[model samples]
Target: MTSYVEALEHLNQTVELHEKWDLEKISQIIARPNATNIQIVGTNGKGTTALFLQKILCAHGFNVGLFTSPHLVNVTERIRYNANCISANEFGKVYMELRDIFDEKQLSYFEKLMVVAAEFFCRHPVDFVIWEAGLGGRLDATTAIKNDIVLFTPIAKDHSEYLGDTLEQIAYEKFFVSQYAKKVYSSPQSQIVQNFMQKQAEIYCKEIFFIPQVSNFYIAETGTVFDIDNQKITIPMLGKHYAQNAALAWNAAQQTLKQKFSVEAGKQALENAAWPGRLQIVQRNADKYVFCCAHNMHSLQSDLEVLKVLREKDILSKNTGVIFAVTRNRPAQQHLQMISKIFPNIVVTAANAQHPIPQELQQQNYAIANEFGDAVRVLQKQGIHDYLIIGSIYLVGEAYKYLELEVRS
Candidate 1:
């Protein structure tokens, strides 16, 4: 038997799935007998929404399985029961066992992971399964499952290479997740998304529920507070945008369970929810640094809004420093313009070989560091009050490792 690390490395070398694969073949390999209730979430906040649903369902005494993608630290994070990450040994054992099946019928990296997770869920016997779309919904690997519920979060320009260039085009691709959904719940979206969703819902014959925007949310020095469905709760995470994300999660949970989920339980889970690499704080010496995997324009804009709000409340000082990096596929100029608009004093760094820091941005930014470690060192030496590390997940992952923060699940 090959070692788990070897198996993981081998899988990583395989190509990613473009769209859906053979569902019958996948089902034959991985039994999903207990996957009667499935929810497919798209775009930003999908992971958080899935986590919220998992907590609420578990609180209601239901066994829940959660499947998310592009894990920040470990592959085990892709699959979970309740709030716990699947054990490494268990993941290794499952992968090693499933390898023979993959060898028998060639599968992509994501395809293998999806099948492994499905098989694991069947063995675990969860009452409900929350599956996050890896990319666009229409042909995503997760679409192989016939979902009972479909959820959509705020959609913005992302994966332009594959999805599309315009918002309408992108929304069209994401709307594909609604095909298998019996009922749909979506956060209030733009006219483009709403119109597209309406058209899709009519064709698919699925009821659509729109979560209202959070009216009143305030951030304190320690955390944030907001009201959802008349239930006021506090979450340890920062940003008013997070309050909206939590509200969306709460509404989705209520809609799915057809019962009033405990506000206190949801609040507690939100407090305990450690979505690392998303506005996560890492400390080095006396400086407090925040790392976020904000790759696209929408997320970067949201993060900037939160930062502005934090600055106004005096939670973050103006002297904060920023270290930015992104993937080559992303629109680097647009992201840099947004960051420059929000943060004047910034330092740019290039990590991945494919996506080097653009010369234009490097010229605009006061400092440019070729390496991640050197970027951190240069930022620290500048005596900035607070630090923000933004861009690709790879950048945040590398920063997490350098800080000696827990990386493995």
Candidate 2:
């Protein structure tokens, strides 16, 4: 695997999670970073929260390495040094070194990437390292490495097959990621999830801090403003949900640094914070597209709320329709129904051949397309200039590919 393409090909050999035996083995062999390890575990906002915290810490002049999953554009998105993704050459070089260990342990794709990130972070020593769990945290590959601080972004029911079927069962599984942490912090969550997390904290003899209520919040066309603990900060992204995620990052940074935390720096850092595939607006010639990664029911609902707010503010056009696609496991019909509430004009399409639109859905009233490009053409033919490409992250990736959008980081 001398090239990035080849490395990705090798990694795809095993896409599913295997036992942790391989992860445990890699954990022992990798040169672990001495930086404070913060594990982010939750169903949604994990990546955004991690990005916010990384930006906050980096703004305070601390070197930070962040590892996030399910890259929007490139594989290098999983590993970052000082918030910059590792270059393909560097990713391949490091991945090449671990080929033997990868094969020896029969490690899954995620496990292999986790080790690569660990090694990459070790090579580029930083003051802090943020590890975002790929899925439910307890048995997630990131948990294989001990963490000093654990942060939970709103827990919700997702990956029911692997986590559980009920909300309590799912939240219980995510709560374990904070068991070994010296300190635990979380964004606002449902009462049930909060209760379970509190109980878990008690069992671990740890104190868990929940981000305080937003003193005030406003969603604007430009961005979302949040007033927390008398600090007025505005994040580049829109929506109250994003404001809450920023609040979580703000509090976590304050607690992590205590006296060293700078309110001004943190506020400024959040203002510049941005995450891909979360209501991201992309312009393609004369047409405008908003790509959102609302794969599961929870995320789809949350994003629809944002979309509703946007529509009310005139930030999103009334004529803006949606291009919906999802993975095989997702509830496509349910997601389409949710989107239809705010966007009745939708075109159903598949992110890839492996996850095609269900046959039943193909017979529905909605317009159908073969792919993202076809979806866009279908909308354009109807004189719909503005579009919302909403569904799985892979769908956003496909849309980006169709637009030939380059990965900035």
The backbone clash count of each candidate, in order, is 0, 0
Clashing pairs in 1: none
Estimate the Cα RMSD of every predicted model relative to the unseen true structure: 2.7, 1.8
Q: What is the TM-score of each candidate against the true structure?
A: 0.91, 0.95
Per-residue alpha-carbon lDDT of candidate 2 for residues 137-235, written as tens digits (9 for 90 to 100) = 777778877799999888888888888888889988888877789989988889988898888788888899998767678877678887977878878
Worst 10 residues of 2 by lDDT: 15-24
Q: What is the lDDT of residue 40 in candidate 1?
A: 52
Residues 1-409, model 1: lDDT tens digits: 2466866876777765554355556555655546655655556777766766676677777788888887766788888987688887788888888887888877877778888888888888688888888787766767778677788888877888788988888888888778777777888788878888888788877778888888778877666677876777766567776677777777777665564566667666666655677766666677787877878877787777877777787666777888888776677777877877767677788855546876666767368888678887887787775878888887887677667688532
Candidate 1: segments with Cα more than 4 A from true spot: 17-30, 352-366, 407-409
lDDT of each: 0.74, 0.84
